[model samples]
Target: MEQSDFYELNDGAKLPAIGLGTVNIQGAKGVNSVLTAIDAGYRLIDTSTNYMNEGMVGEAIRRSTVPREELIISSKLPGAAHDYDKAITMIQESLYRLGIDYFDKYLIHWPLPMQGKYVEAWQALIDAQKFGLIKTIGVSNFLEEHLEKIIDKTGVTPATNQIERHPYFNNNEVVETNKKLGILTEAWSPFGREINDVIEHETIAKIAKKYDKTPTQVIIRWNLQNDVMPIVKSSSLKHQKANLNVFNFELTQEDIQTIDLLDKGEPGRVEGQHPNEYEEFG
Candidate 1:
């Protein structure tokens, strides 16, 4: 990744602007996809304990031509491990699964707000960072209330917050909130996933036509312009390369606004799983 393609975190660690998301990527296929992504210039690999492929990610790293030190491999803590002790043990277990001494960063996978244990989860991550079990700590799927509660209660701010952002639900409020608090926002399923077809959207397609680029390229470019880094998962090597090719073009302010108008607010959520209501225990 180039210097311009890196976002320095609140804690001063750098992450690639584009990341490889390994949600369903597992086994031999998962390993090959990750290895090829590294070779294709992706430096950030995102997975989760819930994804259950930390071991495969480690194997991919070992097989990669790129040095491990040069890449940022991040995983998340699941909702099931919200208790402080459970969270700590899970972090350590994740490292063992990855076959690594310490993770570059680890995240609390979700707030699971109803359970009221995200604060405990945050405290666990803080202690894990202190114990040198992880280099950085962050959260994912945290809405405004959860974000502030964790930071206010723990007196610590996350380095990043991974959220589901796309044209249909740009999540500008949360993204702006994160920006104000010096937290980087990482977008997951930035294309709106299965519920919406971002690549074929009218405005995006129009923009792509004008630029002589694919809608995929245009959307990625728009994401970069909005300052939201997207973690795009594709098992295909060709798709990986396409995701990283957005750096060459710049989207105009008007183009960005035109795309932003596509936002359908809360209804546009890919799975309608509000962090507040979604409960994934494991």
Candidate 2:
């Protein structure tokens, strides 16, 4: 990763502009993929307890040539462990699973507002950070209301907010809100999963051609240019390499404007789970 491709969080921690999102890949395959990405110059790895791959990620880190301190490893607290006590225990369990003493970053996987425990969970995260178990703390799938509630209650703002953001569903309002709060916006599913049309979109293709890059590369560059850190997942070494190769070129202002117009608002949300209504817990 280039020195220019990193964002400084509110806590003064630096995060890679692009991270490997370990969602479905598991076991030896996941380990190898992660190792390959690290070898290919990826310094950030994003995983979660819900993803059930922290163990694999840990194994990969152990086997890789990269030192643990050089990599930014992040995990999330699952909705199943929303209470303060459960959140603390779950983070410890995740640390044990990852074979690490401390995480560079930890996040609440989702607000699950209907459960009404995210504020308490946030407090647990704050305590964990104070305990030296986590270096930086943040949240995922949290909206403006969720962010405000937690900050208002604890007087501690999250270091980052990970949310589903792609060209089709940029969620500009949330991104702006995070910016105003000094919270870095980390984009999950930055490529608009299963939406082949985005990769094949005329505007993206045109921009890619102009920059002599792939459409995916164009989109990733767009995220960086917009000050959004994107977590992109790919099991294939080829795709992973391609994803990391995006920093070489710059996206034109007009091209970015064209992609911006692709936003479809609510209908463009790929995950289909609203933060306010998603209350599932184990």
Best by lDDT: 2
Cα-based TM-score, every candidate: 0.97, 0.97
Q: Over 4 Å off in model 2, which ranges? A: 1-4
How many residue pairs clash in each candidate at the backbone level? 0, 0
Model 1, backbone clash pairs (residues 3+ apart or across chains), number: 0
User: For residues 160-261, could you state the per-residue lDDT of candidate 2 as single tens digits?
Assistant: 999888999988899999999999999988888877588888888988998899999998888888899889999888999899888678877888899999
Residue 211 shift from truth in candidate 1, angstroms: 1.0
Q: Which pairs clash (backbone N, Cα, C closer than 3 Å) in model 1?
A: none
Alpha carbon lDDT at 202, candidate 2: 87
- What is the Cα-based TM-score of model 1? 0.97
